[model samples]
Target: MIRVQARTEQSRLMTFASPLLAIVLTLIFGSILFTALGKDPLQALHVLLIMPLSDAYNVSEMLVKMGPLLLCAVGLSLCYRANLWNIGAEGQLLAGALGGSAVALAFGDSESMWVLPVTLLGGIASGMAWSAIPTYLKLKFNSNLILTTIMLNYIALYLLIWAVHGPLRDPMGFGFPESALFSDAALLPVLSDSGRVHLGVVFAVLAALVAWFILSKSHLGFKIRVYGADEPAATYAGFNANGISWFVMLFAGALAGLAGVAEVAGPIGQLTPNVSPGYGYSAIIVAYLGRLHPAGAIVSAVFLAILYMGGDLAQIEMGIPIAVVGMFQGVLLFFLLACDFFIRYRLVSSRETVA
Candidate 1:
């Protein structure tokens, strides 16, 4: 007979190794997926992982893609650590893009560099405002934040669509559902001439550093962790859970908003329905894969961005389905989550358990 047992000491090594293990498992799953699709698995793997970094242009493009992921992941890390289930980063992102685009379109003619900062501020404010709704509902009416935040996503999306169809629509765009082209002053400065990479990459890296500092070094971060780990204990110790929720949600929303600002100000150059190709949703995967740690999330963000870049490459080279890219990411996240289960629990052999 076999008996299950809990170890006196948790597997500390597994905690650190889970992400790497998940990555390896993802690669294996990807190979199987490609092979099942009748594609050359080795070639697909090479193109997906190795070839993208082989050229300078692709490297820059990778950075461009990584920027938003990094920014959003940083904010989400804070919220997850604080036990605030703010699942509306997608809505917050749209709100930010809409707000930032308003600033850019209104001041597109001005040669002032202040437009960028103004746009960023507008985006952040909009994001925080959007987040405040669920925060307020959760705190006051005792509503479930999870459902409210998720539903708000559709509301924000429709608002964006309405803007493009009406007010933000370019008069000379000939019925195109997009705003006018942003002026040079409204755009982020390019890091390289050939690639679409911009200064937003630097902003993303800085955001990660800020997140690390806040979560690791700040007293507020300690409070957040305490509250998250044990709510009853936190309440007994005098920490206000509502206040913590508000702070974490606002911070996360602000960061996601900054990512929205960066997307329009850097790459897309105007507000459109395609402002985000699921970057907001994808950042959740980045957040968890990074173990809800700022530095880890940054690394995970870069890796996920590579998947985006690699997907494009694979599409061109092998004619693989675009769906495959999402599948790969899903596999990675699924494996990561599964690996985490082993960190606190492990399978025991029958002889060892019986003994």
Candidate 2:
């Protein structure tokens, strides 16, 4: 018989190696999936992985996608480090977009430089406000946050749908479910003259830096680590768990909301029913794949961004289903979890004596 036993001490080496192993496994499984779909695996792999890095324009687009993922993932890392499960980043993002859009629409005629800053603030506030619901419930009623957050995501989506179709609908869009284009002052400045990359990329990098600082150097960060490691120990140390929850949830919501505003004001240029293609959800995978570390999440976000670009490339150039991208993400996460499990436990042979 084979038995699984917990390690006496966790493997520090595996902590770094697991993500790489997960990537390799994901690639192997992805190749098999391509072959099963009746495609040349090597060619498909080239399209999905290699081709995205072949050109400058593609690289820029990948960076553009990376911005939101990085922001959301870094925020989520903070929450996870504090043992706070915040699953409604998607809803918070939508709420932020709506709030920012409302500002843009109201100040559509403004030429002031402050418009942009104010819009971003509106987004952050809205996101924090949305996340506050779950936090409040958990604090006041001892409700489960996971269920509330997930349910809030659907509610936010529906609200976005309604907004685009009714109140925020563009009059000149031929009846499309979209808002008007933001004013020039409301839009984010492009990073380069040729590419769609915007200032949001810089924001994402700054966010990662801030997250690293907080997690590594701050007293509050020390408390969060202690709280996550052992709740009772944290309580005995006189740490306020509820305060930590509020801080993390609100902070995470702010970052996610900023990502939402960036999408509308940078790339999309307007609010729409399809403001996001599951960036918030994908960021969850990014956070874990990066070991819930801020710096690691930056790299993971870039990798996931490549997958997103590759998905579109495969669809257009190789006739592969776009769903394959999502499949790859799911497979990568599955492998990551498996790797983590093995890192914490080992399989050993059990000797049985005849009874």
Q: Which candidate is the best by lDDT?
A: 2
> Which stretches of candidate 2 lie above 4 Å from their native place?
1-5, 347-355
TM-scores, all candidates, are 0.96, 0.95
Model number with the top TM-score: 1
What do the candidate models score in CA lDDT, each in turn? 0.88, 0.90
TM-score of candidate 1 against the unseen true structure: 0.96
Model 2 clash pairs? none
Query: Could you tell me which 10 consecutive residues in candidate 1 have the lowest summed lDDT?
Result: 1-10
How displaced is residue 43 in candidate 2, in Å?
1.4
lDDT of 2 by residue, 1-355 (tens): 8788788988888888999999999999988888898999999888888887888888888889999999889989999998888888889988888888888878877999999999988888988998999999998999998999999989988998998898888888899999989999999999876669999899999999998898899998888889998999999999999988998899889999999888898899899888888888999999999899999999999999999999999999989989888888999999999999878887776762222
